[model samples]
Target: MTVTVRDLRPEVPADVERFARSRHLAIPYVLWTPEAIVHRTTRTHPDAHYRSLVAEEDGETIGTAQVGIAHDSGEPGQGYLNIYVQPDRTRRGAGDLLVRAAEEHLTALGATKLFSWVLDEPGNRAFAERHGYRASRSAHFLRLDLANGALPPLQDLPPGVELRRAADFADDPRPMFELDAETTSDEPSDVGADLTDYEAWIEESWKHPLLDLDLTSVAVVDGRPVAFSAAYTDRATRYSTAMTGTARAHRGRGLAKLAKNDSLHRARAAGYKEAFTGNDADNEPMLAINRWFGYEICATEVRHVRELG
Candidate 1:
């Protein structure tokens, strides 16, 4: 069985589907779709030098890697490569080949440090360790039974505060962009992202294929978006909260929780069955809020870093 790695061909539907399937098999907690895979491959900023690589064994994709520089990071030379091998395809050398190809690409692009998220299982951790990566931080993937679980009832809006759907800003999404930028800067991650490019964010995030604007709930104060819960759906029964945060000024007021609860209630009413989200282990505040919504930790992944010469 010969496992070879090559760049994903976005134009080829089969290639895109296989890549998405491989990723879903390896990491089922997060949502994956063919359209989302293509968007990430082709719409990401050019500075990121993004590439999607797939490992093929006899023309069947068994593993995939999303390799790119952290173009939004303040620090230069920071790269990331998240590799996932289908559960049934492990031990066939696909993972190794995909990693090698991703590392070589980033190294050639002058990346000095690389980061990857490895599942917390022993075999996955050992794989990262053998590749010279050291674990730094961990995050949990949480799931809620949207259709069966009880959601917190919507609370009365504070004076002068209103809840609105992200679709309300379709005419001009700059406010949503501003709110996203502010919250993203504070997210806990190995590579800190500075979202300063509004156009890029519009292309890569606002217009993303998975973004469900109608389901995304936002807290509006004085006609400005102060807190939001961004929702992504598969147009079926599966829904995920891509991000939920409150602006620094609005912290401690429960606006974040308000927005998220509103979003989840609507998601359930709209027939979504399963809800998924992720949080850094250190983000106790958000984790607590998720727990209030009946979310339970389903899986974990550790961020690993490898310094390059």
Candidate 2:
């Protein structure tokens, strides 16, 4: 069987579906849909040079790669290429072809350092090493059975605080944006980000296909959002917490936990059977919070980096 790699054809529904399917198969912990794939292709910042690559064997698409530059990053020459091959279709050279294609594409765009996420399995780790990538910090993908598992009982709102859905910010989401910016800036990462471009955040994040505003819970204090749990749903039975964070001033109040618990209870009540979230391995506070809500580690992935000459 001849396996070849090619750019995903976003205009074609089947290609987008196939790409999402490959990703869903390779990494079930994360949510992936045709609409999300299309959004990434068409709505991402132009400087990111984002391209989704698919590896096809004969007539079947069996693997996918998301390659892009860190366009918004203040540090230049940073790029990322995450590749996922179908479990049932591996050992067919699809992965190698996709990696080569991804590297070539990113290199052509002037990438000096490239990063990728590899599942923390022996074979996957070996694959990265063979490709010249060195393992970095790892993360865990946690899952909670929203339908069958017990969630923390919601507590009475603190005297000065109120809980609200992200949908309530329809009139002006700038406050939510500011909160997101601050929380994200403090998140642990190999490449830190600054979420300053409001217009770009509106297009790339606020308008994202999976962002479920009604399910996202936020804590407000005197009409200002102080903490939040951003939600993403697949319009099916799955839900994920894209982020849960408290503003700097609200850090010691346990507001982040409160926001996430409210969001989780709301999600379970809304019939989302499965819930997924991720956290950096060293983020002890968030990890402890997720554990308090009974989330169990389902998988781990190590960030791998390669420096280009």
Candidate 3:
């Protein structure tokens, strides 16, 4: 009945599957596949110093941690570790063991500040607060019935605008990267991130295992991407909008809704049965856009921060 913390064996299929299962149990909104876990571990930026740890009790993995440095941020010493334990197995010291292991790993990497996402539940918040974490912004996980629900109709773009798919720029995704960078910088969040490294964005985002280029929709004006809705799907009929945004100059033109509707229609036509997405609570425009598409809040998470001296 003793719990121990150890490194997750990426090379072991069972270990990876168990970790994914544990994550699914703890957080069901996000998709977590065995291949996705391996891809993140192997393809993440080297500067990230990413490490996956697991808490084992009686040879069973009861908790998991995703610890890494936020290398994309210009700010240094920014690290993150999200620890989730199986509900039925809590209070067995798995969470405590996992946190100790994760903190030590990140501090060793010279991380001066740490961030984590805690579920918006009393016990979860209490756990983080007791550990010296302060609650920050909150976000909602939204879900849509892609197969049976009615999606908004795609509208014609304005005179200078056109719709295109991500695959259309396979030869050169720099334009999409530029659009993503602009839109993301303006996104409402507790921490503002800059996607300055185009090459790294291409490797981590454009080539992501879940990104379905054909299903993604982009708004092009004067042959330049100004808005986009990135699509990610598992071959198993689950689809999600990784990001949906428009450039600062292109805001208030309904272009975001236009691109999102286009992506939704294409996703449903391609046989995706369930759709998932998330948004910061303060993002009223995006939240309204999602509500217009019939998305409902299924879960919520509060961002918690802890400073390390």
Candidate 4:
């Protein structure tokens, strides 16, 4: 039972399928697909040097690692590698082998600080600690039943606001992108990213395989996207919220709630049966909003950080 780590062969369909399956099984909160796996590898910036590696035992893939530098980050030396080992194959050396390879790759790319997300379980925490990674802020993965769960009824926008779909910005998504940039710049995260590159944002975000523009709801205030909830779907029954935030000027108006609720209602009507989203534990407002939509805490993943010289 020799465990080895190797770069995923994007050209091979089965390899990507296996990798996505393992990831989905290990962390069902986020959406993952073979197309998504391949799109990321093909479209990521070269500076990031992103790669998806699968840990294999004999002929089966038991663990996955998505390693990359935060090339767009204003601050340098930030890199990330999220490792997910199939729950059924945890005791094996797949995880350790995958992390070892990931560390080596990031080091070669001049990464000085590394980040990872581990399930908030004792064993998972121990594994991260044993590897010299220190605990950091945690987040909750929330789930909602779209098929049978009742969603908040869609309401008319307040006096000056209007509801719109992301598809409405097809001709000029720059505004939405700008809004995303503004909100994301302030988002609580271990690695900060700069979304100044329009072309890159189109290739990596707007055109992402899972991004569902029709289901993404945004609140337009005096013709500008003031708040939005980005939705990603597998083009099937599962949907996820990529982000739900509002511009600083629009924070106290419940616009975030309105946008998210609109998006959820649209998603349910579009035949999506399951929905997932995540929020930092301290984000009480967003947490309360999700709860209002009948979402339950499905799981939690704690961000872990490590300093490497």
Candidate 5:
């Protein structure tokens, strides 16, 4: 059987489901649904040049790749291609075909620098290095057994603080947007991003298919949102914390922890059995918070970069 790489057919339900299924088999830690897949290819900003690719072998999709330029970065020519192949489908040229197709696409888009996330296993790292990629920073994927493991007891808010659900701000989500922008600017990432486009944020984040506003928790102080934990659920048993952050002025007060704990507790009560989150290796505070909540590191992935000619 021969493996071929091609763009995903977003309009086909079976094709979209196969793409999502391939992702689930490759990386079960995060949520992947057909709606989320379509939303990504159809709703992302035009400048990003995002395209989802699939590796087909004998009429079956065995791998998937998300290829695009980092248009939000201040630096031009930065591109990313994250590929995941079904665990049972390796050693069949599917991964190689997907990578080659993704690189060709990004290079055609004038990307001078290419980035990809490689699982930290020896074989995966070897594959990336053999393709001229060098390992850089690393990140850990943490998992919490919300259905069985013990979670930190929820704490009461301080005298001037109160816990609120993100749904409470549905009538006007601009405040949440402002808080997200401020906190996201401080996140540690290789490509610095400026979330200045309010309308884009609403379309990309606020209206995302997986965002669960009812389960999201926010810490409000004097009617102002100071800390928040955004929740994304697959409407099944898996829940992931998309983002958790506290404002600069509210740092060192443990408000972010409070928000996350509340959010996690609510998720558990709502029948979410598994929780997943990611943290940069250099991010100590957030890592500590996850550790405090009984989240254990399940996997690690290293960022690899290749300079394109």
Candidate 6:
């Protein structure tokens, strides 16, 4: 069986579906859809040089990779390549070929450092190590049974603060953009992003195919968004928190938890059954809040890095 790696044909519906399916089968915790994949491939900033690749065996796509330069990062020459192979299609040359293609693409674009997330399992880690990547920080994929789990009761709005849905910012989303930029800059990650482009955020995040504006909860103080929990849904039974954060000035007030709780309640009310979220292992505050909402760590992935010549 000859396995070949090639660029995903975004124009081909079947190819896009297969790529999304491969990702879902390999990493069930994260949300992936054909629309989301296409958005990431086409809507990402040109500076990112994003490319989605698929590994095919005989006429079936069995693996996928998202390769890109970290354009928004303050540091240059940092690139990322995340690969996933369908569970039933492993041990083939798909993974290695995908890696080779991804690395070559990024390296040709002047990437001096490459980062990848590998499942915490021994085999996955060994595979990354075999390709000269070393494990660094780790993150956890947390899941909550929104249908069966007991969510915290919605608390009365604190004085001077009001709860609002992300849709409320439809007429003017600059405030939401400001809040997102602030919170995103503080997120713990191997590559730091500077969200200074409002237009880019609108296209790449606010208008994302999976973003569920009606279910996204935000805390507003004096008409300004201070905290928020961004929601993403598969438009089915699955929901996820894309991001939950409090503005720097509002960190000590538990506002992030409040927003997230409100968002979760809204998601459950809207018929979402399962909710998934991910957090850096060192982000104790967010972890504590998720635990309070009955989320359990279902899986962990370690970030690995390799310096390219």
Give the whole-model CA lDDT for all candidates, comma-separated: 0.94, 0.93, 0.89, 0.92, 0.93, 0.94
lDDT of 3 at 215: 88
TM-score against native, each model: 0.99, 0.98, 0.96, 0.98, 0.98, 0.99
Off by over 4 Å in 4: none
Candidate 4 local lDDT, 1-309, one digit each (tens): 888899999999999999999999999889999999999989997888999999999999999999999998999988999999999999899999989999999999899999999999999999999999999999999999999998988877799899999999999999999999999998988788778999889999999989999999999988999999999999999999998889998899999889999889888888899999999999888899889999999999999999986
Q: How many pairs of residues collide in each model?
A: 0, 0, 0, 0, 0, 0
- Candidate 2 matches the true fold with a TM-score of 0.98
Tens digit per residue, CA lDDT, model 2, 1-309? 899999999999988988888899999999999999999899998889999999999879999999999986778999999999999998999999989999999999999999999999999899999999999999999999999999989988889999999999988999999999999998898877889999989999999999999999999999999999999999889999999999999889988889999999999988899999999999898899999999999999999999998
What's the C-alpha lDDT at position 240 in model 1? Answer: 99
Better of 3 and 5 by TM-score: 5
Alpha-carbon shift of residue 278 in model 4 (angstroms): 0.3
User: What is the lDDT, from 0 to 100, of the residue 109 in candidate 6?
Assistant: 95
Pairs clashing in candidate 5? none
lDDT tens digits, residues 87-196, model 3? 89888998888888888988999998889999999988999998889999999999999999988877777888999999999999998998899888877765668888
Q: Which runs of model 3 end up more than 4 angstroms from their true locations?
A: none
> Which residue segments of model 5 deviate by more than 4 Å?
none
Ranked by lDDT, the better of candidates 2 and 3 is: 2
Candidate 2 root-mean-square deviation in Å:
0.8
